[model samples]
Target: MHLARGAVFSLLLATGLALPGSEGSKHHANKARSAGYALKEPPLTTPWTDKVGTEPWPEYPRPLLQRSEWKNLNGVWKYQNASGLNAVQNPPFGQALAQDVLIPSCLESGLSGVQADWALYSWFSTSFEVSSSWKGEKVLLNFGAVDYEATVFVNGKKTGFHRGGYFRFALDVTEHLVFNKQNELLVFVHDPTDDGDYVIPIGKQTLRPSHIFYTPCSGIWQTVWLEAAPVNHITQLDIDGNMNGQVNITVHSSAKDAPAEAEVTVHKDGKVLATHNGPTNKPFQFTVPSPKLWSPNSPNLYNVTVKLDKDEVESYTGFRTISRGKVDGIERPLLNGEFIFMFGTLDQGYWPDGLYTPPTREAMVYDLQVLKKLGFNMVRKHIKVEPELFYQACDELGLLVIQDMPSLRPSQSKHVENCKSVPILPDEKQQAEFTRQLDVLVNQFKSFPSIATWVIYNEGWGQITDYYPEFGLTDRVRQLDPTRLVDSTTGWHDHGAGDFSDNHHYANPQCGTPFYSADSSPFDPSRIGFQGEFGGIGNNVSIEHLWKNQAAIDSINRTYEIDTTIEAWNYRSHILLGELEEQIRLFSCSGGVWTQTTDVEGEVNGLVTYDRRLARTDEKQWQADIKALYDAAAARSNATTATL
Candidate 1:
C-alpha cells in the first residue's frame, strides 16, 4: 500500500486529488519552523489539533438514547459570517458560500478553521439527500446545541427555531422532505454572548476574556445529525435508582393517545436480568433479585431495551442511590446507605482548540479517563452544562457529577466584593428566562445516575435574591428532580435553601478558615458541609501554547510563579491533600472539591493543561494519595456509623 513520495504525489494528482502534504504543506512547514525559534508568537495549536480532519467529531452525540439508523451531519459545510449587508433574513442557499467551516465546532474555535469572532448573524448551508432506506420512518433533525438563538430552514421553508446554547433540540423535517432529491439544510444563528442587553446564561464566556473568564463561543458548538424513527416512539426515559433492589422507570412516548403497550428488558452481558411490560407514557418499577449496586469501585451498569410496535431503543442505567446521612455527627453524602466522601476536581471541560466543543470524541473521553485513572470518584462540572456524552461518560466510568447551571450576566465585581448584603435583582424578563432555562436544564439531565447533585447557582454569579415568592430557583430544581441533592448556591450569597452548605477557598487552605474548614465539631446542623471549591494551584506548561492575551499571560505568570515546575506543582498537590485530610479528620467535613481539573484559557489554576498536555502531579503518586485519602475517610465513616 506504500508508495514513493513522488509516486504518491503523482498518483494523487493523477486521480484528481491533492496529496496530504501538498495542499498546505509549505504553510505548515513555515509555521512549524517559525513556531519557536524565528517567530515572536507561539503556534496556536495542540498536539491533537491536526487530528480534526475532514469529518470531525463523528461519534454518536447521544449515547443515553441511541438509534441505529442515523446520519452524521458533521464535516465541512458552507459558512459565512453575516455582517453588514450579508446579514439577511433568509439564507443564500444557492449562492457559493464565502468560506468553509467545520460543523459541530463553533466558528471561534481553531478546529473549525474559521477562528472568527462572535458575529451578530451567521449562516450555515449544507445539502443532503434523503436515504432511500428511510422511506416510511419519520425524519428528525437533531441539534446537539446552538448558542443563544437559531433558526433552521429546510428547502427554503422555515422548519424551527431554538434558543439556549447548552441543551439539545430537534426539528421534524419529514414534512419538508423530497424523496430522492437533494435537500438544502440551512441554519441561521444569532448570539449576543454576554454582550447583549438581554441577560442570558453565558457560563464562563466573556467578551473581553481575562483571568477566569474565557473567549465567547457562538453559533453551533455541538453535533448536528438526522435520525429516523417510527411515528410512535419513545421520546424520553427517566430512571431513578431505588433502595429496595429496584429502579423506577418513566417512559415518555410521542403518541398523543394511549400509546401501545411497551416492553422493557434489563440485561447485563447479553443475559436478561429483568423484564416488565408497561403502557407507554407511564411509570413502571422493575426489581432485580440480588441487584449489584453501582459504586466507584464497581460501576455495574445494566443495559435496557424498550420495544413499542416498530420502534425499538437501547439504553443503560446504573443501580445506585444517593442520600444524606450523619457520619461522626457531620452530615455527609451517602451512596447506597453508606457514607462516602466526595473527592473530585472541578471539571470545566474546556479545550485549547475547541472552545465549547471538544476536538474529537476520543479527546472528550480522554479527559474522563484521566479523572478515573487518577482515582477520583466525582467531578463538579463547574458553571456550564456539557453535551450528554460527558454525562454518559461519567455514568459509564462511575464518576459522580455535581452539575452547575450556567449563569447569566455574572458580575465579577459583585462576586468578589466584600458585602454582607446587596439589593441584587434581575429584570422581570431576565428572571423569567433564567427560571425557564433552569427547568430546561433539570429536565435535560435528570436521567443520569452519575449526577448526584444539582448546583443551582455558583458564587452568587446570577443569584439575584434570597427568595422567589413563586417557588424559588433551588425549590424549583428540587421539585423537578427530588432524586438528587441540590447545592442552591456554592460560595457566597447562599439562598439558605438546598441540601448542602457549600463554600469556596483559594490559594492555600489551612485550619481555622471560617466556612472553608470546620476546625471545631458541631458545625451548622441544618445542611451537609461541603467545600465546593478550593486549592487553586497554578502551574504553567509551555509558553508556546499559552493564550493570545499577553497581558493576561503576564499577569498569570507573575501571580502563580510559586508552582513553576511539575515538582513544585506536586508539592502543592500534597499540601492540598494534607489540608483535605485535616478537613476530614478535625473538621468532620462532608466533602471537598479541588479548584479545577484542567487549565482554562488565561488561567493556569488546573491539575492539567488546557490541551491536556501536562499534569500537575504524577499519575501514580496522585492516585495513590487520593486512594489513601478515600480509605482513611471510609474507615472514619465506618467507625462513626458503627456507633449509630
Candidate 2:
C-alpha cells in the first residue's frame, strides 16, 4: 500500500513504456533518468483475486502431490514479446499486440498488462477447451515458477524444457491434447537480467539501481496452469522425520514399471492415527504417539493421506528436529529438544505492487501473519523461494524457516578485483542449470517440517574463486537434504564446510567467536557461531516507495538526509533496539536473524514497512524488547540445566 515516488514515476512516464525493443526506442536519453528507478514488473492478479472470473490461481497448486480431478489453467492469456527463433515461431495471433495478460502475473506487473519491459524472451499463447471432465485424463502441465528458462508447446509439438528459475515444473500434456477442440498452449521464456550468468539470486536486483540493489526480476515470474492426472499418479512426496520420533515416507511415481502402492494416513483431530501400507519404492516407517513438536511455538500439523489405488492424495506433516547442540558450553541451535533461540526476519518477499508475486493468497498469508504478529519466531527466507502456499503458511503459522538458495553469486570486495564470481565450476556445464535448480529446490522443499536451515552461500553470491577450497558446495548440500541444516556460506568467505560459524555484520551486531566460556562445562565443539547478517535500519517510508528516481531521490535526499521528526523515528527505533539488545546478550548467542522483515526495494533497513503497512519498531515496545530477549535466553537455558 506504500507506492508514491511521484506517483510511480508518473505511471511509468505515462506508459510510453520503453526498453524492450528498438532498444526501447534507444533508452530515450536515459528515460527521464531511468524513471526514478525500481523497475521489475510482471504478476497480474491471481494469487487468488477475490474469487470468480479470470479464475485466479484457484488453489490446488500441488499440495505435495495432491490430485482431485483437476483443470484450472488460470485465465486470460495471449502475451507477446518475442526476440528471435522466428518470433517464437510465428506468433502475432489475433493481432492486438498488447493488453490482456494475466496467467500467473509477470510482464513487469501492474497486473502484467505488458508493463515496461524486462523481458528476455516471451510468448505465452493460450486457448483452452478440453474439460469434458478432462476427457481421458493425463494432461498435467503445472509451473508455479519460471524465471530463468522454460519452453513448452502443444499442438505445435515441443513438450518440455524447464531449466530452473526457482523450481516446480511438470508436463504431460497427454500426448498433446486436441480432444474436444481448441488446443494451442505455447510458452517460451528465457530470463538473464543481471548478466551474472544465471543461478539467479540477484536479490535486491540491479542493472544499475542503487544501495542494496533493486528491481531486475525477469520473465514469467511464477504460476502457469493446466492439470489432469491419472494413468498412475502421485509423482512425488518424501517426508523424513527424526530426533528419535521416527517417520519416513517416500512415494514417487510416473510409472517406472508401475506396480506401486502406498497408503500411509495419519491425522489428528480429524481422526486416523496410523495406517501404513507399503511399496511405492520403499521407505515407510511411522511413530508419533506424543509427537506434537514443531516450533516457533507449537505449529503441530499431521493430516497426510497418500493412498494410491483409487488415486488419492492430501498432505501435511510436521514433527521437527533440527540439530547441532551443546547450549551453555556453546555450539547452539537445537529445536525440538531445546536450545531454541532463533529469533527472526530477513524475509525479502518483496512487492511494492507485486514484484515477486504476492498480491494475494491473503498477500501470502499477510506476510506470515505480520511476522507472527511481530513476535517473529523465525524466517530468513531472504534469497527468495516461496509459494507452496508460502511454505504452507510457514507450516500452518508457526514460522521457523531458514531456506535460502536463490543465489547466483556477486558480493565480495577487496576493492572489487574478482568482483564476486562463480562463472561455472563444480564440474561445469554451467553447473548444469544449478544442479537442475538444486534438484528442484531439494525435491520441492525436502519434506518441510518448517525447514530448519539450508543457506549455501549468500555474501559470496555465486562464489567460485580459486575454487573456494575445492568447493564441495556444502557437500553438495549434504547430498541433498541429509535432512536440513547447511549454512555453507552466509557471509564473508569461510570454506570450512557446512553447519554454523557464519557471520555478517552491518549497522553493527557482533559475535565473532565464543560458543561458551564460564568455566565451560559445555559449548565448544569447534566454535560454532552465527550473526549471519546484522541490522540495516534505513527507514524511507515511500519516496515512491523508492526503487529510485527524482535524481535518484535527489541523490538519496542529498546524501542520507538526517533531519528526522516523529521524534527522530522514535529515537532511531530506540537506538536500534538497544543495539539489537546488546547483540542478543553476547556470549554464546545461539540466535540472531534480523537485517530485514520489510522495506525492500531501496532496502530501507526494514523492521516492517514496504506494505506490510509500516511498523519500524513499537509493536508494543518491540514486543517488550522481544520478551526480554526471550527472557535472557531462558535464563541461559536455566543456568545450563542447573549445572548438570
Candidate 3:
C-alpha cells in the first residue's frame, strides 16, 4: 500500500509502527516515496562533503598502479528503482529513467541524491565514447566494488558479471563497444544484505539498527571507470622486502604471447637505487644500496616502475621485518627485529553522508592522519575491507594494520548476547561460500607492507567453533601467506590455534588475563598477548554534532553515558589508561586497541564527534599518555618473567 502524505504519513511517524522485517519495511519505504513525501534532511555531513561537486572523486582511483590516460567516469547517471517479480531481468533499454544518482555513491547515501532506504534491484544507464587516440586498444571497464552482484551491458550486448562485493573487478568490453560514436552502457544490480531469501557477509549492518550497528549501503559504493590497455598489459604487482634490503618483485601480466619480457626499476627521492630485467609472471629479486629502514618515525618508501612489452605500470614498496620471539622469557611481537609496542584504535570506516564510501579522499585520510598525530603506531581495521588507497595511506604514513576478513552471520538483536563469545556454526553451503570469499580477500590484499597481522575470525561471529581447528581455516591462512601473523579467533572461543592470545573487556579491563585455549590452559608465557578491544567511554556532544537521522537519535537517547562534558570524559579516560598500565604487568600485554577511532551512528563513544567537527579530548594530553604507555610497555618487555 502506497502511503499518502500529510495526515496519513504523520500518523505512522508518530506511532512508530514500522513494517516487520527488512524486506517489508524497504518495500513500504519505496512505496511511500512513490506517493510523494519529501526526503528527510541529511543528519550530518563531513567537512569535505560540500567540496564534492559534479565529479566527486575525480582523482585517479588506482593509486598503487596508475596509467597515464584512462577516463574517469564518476558523475551523474540516470537511475530507476524496480523491485517487482522480474525487475532484474527486464532492462529499460532506450527508455528514459525517472531519477538521477551520482555514480560511485551508494543508494542510501545523501551524496547520491537518492537517499533510498533500500534498493534490491535497480538499473543505471549512461553513455560514453572510446578515446579517439586509442584505435585498436582493448577498452577495459572497471568497478572498485558493487554491493553484492552486477551485470554489465554495452550497446545492448552482455559483457560480464561479478559476484563478490569487497574487491575490484574488470571486463574487456572491446568486442561490445561502438567506437566512433557515443556508446550506451547499462548496469543491473542486486544486493540482498539482509532483506531477501539469502544472506551474505554483513559487518554490523541492520534494518532496525541499534546503537552500534548501522544501516547498510546498497548498490555501487565505490569508483567506476574505463581504461585503455594494450593486448599484453601488466595485471598485478606483488612486492616484498626484508631487513637487509633484499627486495623481491613479481609482475603478473595478461601475456597472450608466452614468456613476455619485462623490466623493473627502483627509486628513492627520484634517484635510481636498483634495477632488474626479467620475464613476466615470475619472481624477480634485486637489492637497494644502504637501505634506510621504514619505521613509524622515518616512513621510508621506494618507488618502483615495471615494463612488460608494450605495457608499463608504476608501484611502490617498503622494507621492514616482523617476527615474534622471547624478549626476556616472555614472547612478544618485534618490528624490525626489535620490540615496539603496538598502540591503536579500532577503525570502522563509516561516514554519515556517504555511508560505506567516504565523502572525499581527504576526509578518509584525515582519520589516519589524526591518529598518527595523536601518537598511535597501528590500527586494527575491523571487519570491513577498505579500498586499496586506504592501505597505501597506511604504508606511506608508517601505520601498522591488523586487517580483518569480513564475516557472514545471522541477524543481531538490541544488544550483543553472550559477550560475543559464542559462534553459530554454518552448514555446508554457507561454509563453502565463506571460504570462497576468504580466498578472494587474501589473494587481493597480501602485498601491502603495512599489514602486520591477518585476523581470520572476530568475536566468534562466523566461526564453526567446534570444528575450527579441524576445519583448517588457520592452516589455510598460514599456507596462503606465511609472512604475517595469523589470529584464529580474536576475542573468545580460542581453540588452541593461531599466534597471539587476545581478549576483550569493557569499563575496567585489568580484572584478569585470558587463557590461550578453551580448556582454560594456564597462561603460556611463551606466547604473545593483546587486549583486542577495550575502553568504550562515551562523551555526549551537542545535537548539531550528532547524526541527524531519527533512528540514530533514538539510539543515542537509549545508550548515551554519564560523561556528558569534555572535562569529565578526560578524567574518566585518564583513570582508564591507568588501569591498562597495570594490565601490562599480567600476561605481558604488548598492545591495546581503544574501542574506536571516532563516533559512528549512535555509538557516542569516540575521541571526536561524528561529523569530526568537534574533538572531545586534548590532543597533547593523548600524545603524552600514549608515550607514557609505550615507556611502560618497553619496561615490561625487559622483565625476565610475568605473572599469569
Cα deviation at 128, candidate 1, in Å, is 0.6
Residue 502 lDDT, candidate 1, scale 0-100: 72
For candidate 2, what is the TM-score?
Answer: 0.36
Candidates 1 and 2 compared by lDDT, better number: 1
lDDT (CA) for every model shown?
0.73, 0.64, 0.73
Candidate 3 clashing pairs? 43-548
> What residue runs in model 1 are displaced by over 4 Å at the alpha carbon?
1-43, 84-88, 412-425, 466-471, 510-523, 557-561, 640-644
RMSD of each: 9.3, 21.2, 8.4
Lowest lDDT block of 10, candidate 2: 22-31
Which sections of candidate 3 miss by over 4 Å? Answer: 1-40, 410-425, 469-471, 510-526, 557-561, 638-644
Find the candidate with the highest TM-score and give its number.
3
lDDT of 2 by residue, 1-644 (tens): 23345543211101111111110121011111212122234222222332212444556666766766665666556666778545656645434334456666656655554564557778776666666777666888788887767877877888888766667888897887877787777787877656543445455555555545555555666666666667787778898766665788888767867777778887888887778788886667878577666777778887788877657888878887787777667677777778777778788887755567765566677667766876778889887787787888888899888887776644522233567542432336555555556666776888978888888667666666566631476677677677777876777666566777666665455543433223112322454566666666454544434544443344333223232333454466556556655544556556677777765555555665564544556566667776776777777777753221
Question: In candidate 2, residue 121 scores what lDDT?
Answer: 74
| Cα RMSD for predicted model 2 | 21.2
- The TM-score of candidate 1 is 0.88
